[model samples]
Target: MKVGLYFGSFNPIHVGHLVIANHMAEYSDLDQVWFVVTPHNPFKKKNSLLDDYQRLEMVYRATKDYTKLKPSDIEFKLPQPNYTINTLAYLQDKYANFEFALIMGEDNLKSFHKWKNYDVILENHHVYVYPRISGNHIETQFDNHTKIHHIDAPVMELSSTFIRKAIKAGKNVKPMLPEFVWEYLDEMNFYK
Candidate 1:
């Protein structure tokens, strides 16, 4: 099985994430797109993030109906300050039968050089980059690299940070997320 690992904090899963994951599963070579919920991303500020379990529940609620998409808690059991390279290495070892690829936004690709052992990641696994609204100026390096794949998944201007701000301001962010997930958020009084 070929899987595209879509890693994120998923502080609260939203439609943008679903759309991209669906696009990858539908238009790309990946058979499955797993939402690997990171407990703590070294690149992100951890204080504002929801609990890892809460984020996982939201991911599950947001993606439950989509068979090709799955919510993964793989990072929850791993070490803190999750690193993509480490997770990729671990997944490669554990799921020897399944081929894994990294799914990320073009913006991330621009900053890819800063990641730990990025060369190893590009060498070992495929990378599928979806375009982002703010990164049109960024040029993809290693254009001739065999494992890098640039795909045209729809660009979603919406972001999880905006969604959280909306929710905290007592605004309804239902349109930004799957209905089930919004309902779950309401029930839990999350981000209050």
Candidate 2:
């Protein structure tokens, strides 16, 4: 089976996330898009991050109805400061029958070289990058071994930070998130 790994914090999963995953699954060769919830990203700041388990639950809730989209807590069991290369290695070892590809925003592609063991990842994995407002400028320094595919998906400006701020301020997030996910967030008082 071919799987596209969509890694993110998923502080509170929203419609935008689902849209991209659906797009990838429907339009690409990938059979499924797994939301790999990262416990802590080495490249990102630690402050204001929700608990990993909580984030996983939100992802689960958001993606429950989509058969092709799965929320995975794989990174939660791994060591802190989760690295994509390490996760890819682990997944390959655990699921030898499955072929996994990386799914990320165009922004991440710009700094792909800064990631741990980037050369190995580039050589081994197929990356599907979706366009984002930032990080569209690609450098010509990438190695030839990397297989990068650009995907065109509708851009939703909503972000986890903005959603969190809205929730904290008691503002409506109905337009930003899916109906069910918005309900769950309100019931759990997430981002409060």
Candidate 3:
């Protein structure tokens, strides 16, 4: 099985995220897409994040009905300031039968060089790069790399940070969130 790992904090899973994952699972060569829920991302501030378990729960709620999509808490036990390379290496070793690839947007590719051991990832695994507005340099930089595939999946402006802000401001983010997620957020008064 070829699994694509879509890593994120998912402050809260939004429609945009679901759409991208769905597109990759259905249209791309990936057999399944796993949303690797990170406990802490080195690139993001910890103060703005919800509890790791809460974030993981939200991801579970958002993907409960999706058969090809899964929510993973793999980074929870590994270490602080979770690094993608470490998680990828661990998963690769544990699941030797299944092939793993990285799923990211073009925006991430622009900063891919900054990631720990990014060259190793590009060299060993295939990458599915979805289009994102304002993301450049991919065609110029990765054009020669066969593993880096550029896809035209639907782009969404929604983000977990934006959703959290809306919720804190008492805005209705129901349309941007899954039904179960909206229910959970309303009941728990999260991010308020």
Instruction: Report the C-alpha lDDT of model 2 over 73-115, residue by residue, as the tens digit.
Output: 8887788766788899999999999999999887777688888
Model 1 vs. true fold: TM? 0.93
Which stretches of candidate 3 lie above 4 Å from their native place? 41-45, 135-140
Candidate 1 worst ten-residue window by lDDT: 135-144
- Residues 128-183, model 3: lDDT tens digits: 99988664544547766899888789878888888888888989899999999899
Highest lDDT: which candidate? 1
Encode model 1's per-residue lDDT on 76-124: one tens digit a residue: 8788776888898888899999999999888888788899999988888
List per-candidate RMSD values in Å: 2.0, 2.5, 2.1
Model 3 C-alpha lDDT versus the unseen true structure: 0.87
Point out where model 1 deviates above 4 Å. 41-47, 135-137
Candidate 3: worst-modelled 10 consecutive residues by lDDT: 133-142
Show the colliding residue pairs in model 3. Answer: none
How good is model 2 by TM-score? Answer: 0.90
Per-candidate TM-score against the hidden true structure: 0.93, 0.90, 0.92
Choose the strongest candidate by TM-score. Answer: 1
Error (Å) of candidate 1 at residue 72 is 0.7
